[model samples]
Target: MTVDHVRSLSSGINQTGVRAYNERLLLSVLQRNGALPGGELARRTGLSPQTTSVILRKLEQDGLLHKGVPVKGKVGKPSVPFDIEADGLFSMGLKIGRRSADLLVLDLKGEVRMQLRETYDYPMPDTVFGFLERGYEDLMSALSIDMRSRMCGLGIAAPFELWNWHELVGAPPAEFAAWRDIDFSAEAARITDLPVHQVNDATAACRAEHVFGMGREYRDYVYFFIGAFIGGGIVLDHAVFEGNQKNAGAFGPLPVPDVQGKPAQLIDLASIRALEVRLEADGLDPRQLWQTPQDWSHLEAYVQPWLEQTADALAIASVASCAVIDFEAVVIDGAMPATCRARLVEMTRTRLSDQDLRGVIAPEIIEGRVGNNARGIGAAAGPIISQVLLNRSAALLGALLHKLGSERTSPFPGRTYPTGSVTGMPRAV
Candidate 1:
């Protein structure tokens, strides 16, 4: 994630050629460091002043960079800093969870411009894609023609091996088996001409935290996203790192000690779904757990005990991950409200103190700020960062695409035209 020096590159945005690596390098610097004058940008990227000025002008004209307030220095001309234009581009993030789904628009600045959510017992094909079709229309209709034109692509954050969780979600065998053949990225591509990117849902949350939340504060950390099932993502050298199969921080299966000193999977003890099971066993309305605009204060009595157990499991998982990476912090986030996140973080810290750390240096436990909306927002970031901005994971995405047989390096990757939304695309019976 460190910005290294690259020298002598020239390719204007208007010209019919590839976007210069130098330009993305400059954009990456501005993105990480905020507004800086040409000289400062040059110093940061190791580009000469002339090259920096030219790239800045091209990016500004291309609607990617904009001028900031002039700052008078101790000497010469009052230099104007250049900032990544917040409205310069737009992308969509779709988070497909077992209990609900969300679609959102993200600007270059990592802010959510618009979002829509739907809750369901389980994700049925028609229901999921029907919601997507409607959400895409509604979201795109709300955008100005210019904004719509600026739409980059769609990114999907879905759980890994979604079909395998049918039993846990109480779905019928037939309905659950349908998920085995679902290629979310391809299905999404049917609606918008924009290139579609897919990532593990928890990793998407981690990406959001890295790009817009606490990621800037630490270079190496393990992130846990407490959703229907507890999951995690890894950050190495400041970028979200998905390993060879794109499942590096799959923490659900991580071993933790139960209250009886018996071994258990982190998911068994740490997930929100576990809480729902607790509520159901007590004859409380479990659906309330998945409701949007969530305030678990209503279920405070039930939440307290769940919180304690989840915190204990999280503390152990945090230590186990840090033991391998020597991470500086364990950044914890979830598909829950800020209050819940705060309590979990506080409790985790306390529980962490109780773990037997004979050899490993326990990492600092930090609360995530992105909250429940993180997976969707992180999904949105994938396309924008792949096309407009720069990230270390960009290379991983390229490799992934290559494995899928596409070397997409443009605004449009494989198919360069919008096919428009159809009721359905290819599927198996």
Candidate 2:
């Protein structure tokens, strides 16, 4: 489908777009299952063999698919497997994090090719826009002209009304206020020649998880992302449900008691910023926490209290979340190490066991596979989903995939908690 048709179809699908839909269906099959012969694709997609052949030819001609090694069949002509052209399309992701800005480029298979990030005390309009300008230029210079032209669109992930949290992050009100009047996505589109999409930072992270991480298995789950602040997103019926106001997973504002037994939002107790506050009081540099997961090794003393409170808050939130939605799992990830994530999951489960879960089918707490990279990766997927999958009438195909789930090995396997494996979360049944 042309870009114009893709844009129009994103609003809603219709009978007229069935061809585009079939194309996306076949592509998605190849994406999830690696490679398969045309007849196999036809059977898997329930499309007529002739229709599958026609679509395969067109996709090959369009440079989106290619024939792999021929395999000797039991009888008749040898079958040739077709696979996706990873370089067929590309999307850019921009994450306007509270403390930093990250620009990333992802190919068709969702692999990062180029990334740029910079940290600042607080974001200002000029500074953010300038970073986008330079980052875009650097990315383009590194790509061949042909590859650059194949760019699909750009997706920006940031907390909405970020200026409202200036006090929490210790930023000057005026400097942060500049964000209130600025449309970062519009500015990004102006800086680049690609169409732009925007979503809440946490939601973007959840999107990444849905598309590239656990969504490959579980279709219904509650997501919690620990950044400078704790944020959340929900995936129901195989898609991220943003709710009426686009804040379905805004778990930060949930009421929780602080250390002093005073009421406070969950964010105040469960965020990395809370840990940072404690570290600062102990005369330690807080920047070390954001550098990488490994830097948090010696922080057991400071992180322990936050962990106890965070586990309690998460347990309460998860129980309440399950009472309303029959989620299959609760995914937790953040700017911390795998061990740290495992410990949090371990504690949350312990706390959850103590809660009065009557009338609620409690969800299993699972560590997110995406971790700190979710927002950037998920932000990168927004435009791809909008311009590719949703734009085509491929909602049927998406539903089918959701039912079938990942047939191949998972990206992070055998690391689920309770079992004490550090590799990844357990596969959801």
Candidate 3:
């Protein structure tokens, strides 16, 4: 369907949708607080006890929740605490990067069950699709029929315009240009016949962090994923803030000074591409170095300058971002090795510490736990977030309605919002 048509779909918040929302809320509560009794879940979610019990029963039957040992209270009978069942569902996360393709099968608890990765010069439509198909088949082959049936959906994480960075990626213009006409999510949907969601690779990485990593501890943070190009995402009040164009944290465009003291975007100095450019100038195989940062120890001459420049640019960006929204942490992740990430984080921290802090509280500079897999894992979560975690159709409808600032007749056959409403899109990030 068309984008406008999808947005026009009514957030059917009838009695049925209320149960769905409650089911999600119950899962969220248990996930955040561990096992809790039905009464506690109801109290936390503001759902009626009877409604909570009913939803809990249904979720239990669906294997999405499990009952723990009963706990006897002082004033009441023993109550069984319910917890999320990590194996109840699964999502397929795929990342098509400029240099590599990765596929991961993630369980409900965000654990990776299967991973397949390949390095290539650049992604070609046929090769990328073939890689995904093989990966999906391998994943299904490893699962039972019942488990396979529980597959929530597929999430594709890639750059919005893969062909646009041909120069940075060292790809032929004509070959890379082919990506301009390819619709990644649609093609995957056609091949897999599974619900597909697409997101910018950086945003997907941030979502991965939000759902499985630092997000558990901090709700507000500015996420920077240092891949081929520096990418960013923002989280506020525990939800990713996607701007009108779904590119709120496009950090590559943030301005910074270049080596020549000329004004340039952060991506020019802080991204892996910048390092690659430096390495290439010194007659080293950048592709090999990209895969193995540990080998860069001998190339200290090139590495030191890039690290210094990158740290400076990141410090400036972190200060600017915190000044605007006051994030609690600045998470840096990348396609490079973990040691590289750690060193970068350390350098960034030092640079940030040196900055003047008169009016704004400096956000903690931290290394991202997801690393390079963030985008793929987050993409895999798209289907789960949309189908099980929350009622996205309802949430998007509510957003469109709110944006319009008035009630309008919805063409879809469903109840309008009244019973309940979810506030954010399931796959916005």
lDDT of each: 0.80, 0.76, 0.77
TM-score of each: 0.87, 0.83, 0.83
lDDT of 3 at 256: 78
Error of 1 at 235 (Å): 0.8
- Look at candidate 2 and give me any clashing residue pairs: 415-424
**lDDT by residue for model 3 (1-429), tens:** 332222122112111222355577677666656789988776666667898898889998977888999998898799999988888787788898888889988888888888988778777888899898777766666766556667767899888677888987778899879999898878887666677899888989988887778766776889999888899798875677666777779999898777687899998889888888898887887777655323566777887888889999999899989989889999988887777788999999999988887799999998889877899998998877776675322235447656544433333344233322232222110
lDDT of 1: 0.80
Per-residue error at 405 for model 3, in Å?
11
Write model 2 residue lDDT over 156-221, tens digit each, in one string.
888967889989878888777888888776788667756788889998888888777876677689
lDDT of 2 at 390: 39
RMSD (Å) of each candidate, 1 decimal: 11.0, 9.5, 6.9
Question: Per-residue lDDT tens digits of candidate 1, residues 1-429?
Answer: 110100001112213234666787788777776788998877665567998999999999989999999999899999999999988878889999989999999999988999999899988877888888788877877777667667777899998888888888889988789989887877877765557899999989999998888987787899999999988798876668888888878999999889898989999999989999999998987889887678889888889999999998898888888778799899888978788889999999999999888888889999998888889998999888777665568346445445544323334344322111120110000
> Which residue pairs in model 3 clash with each other?
93-380
Which of the two candidates, 1 or 2, achieves a greater TM-score against the reference? 1
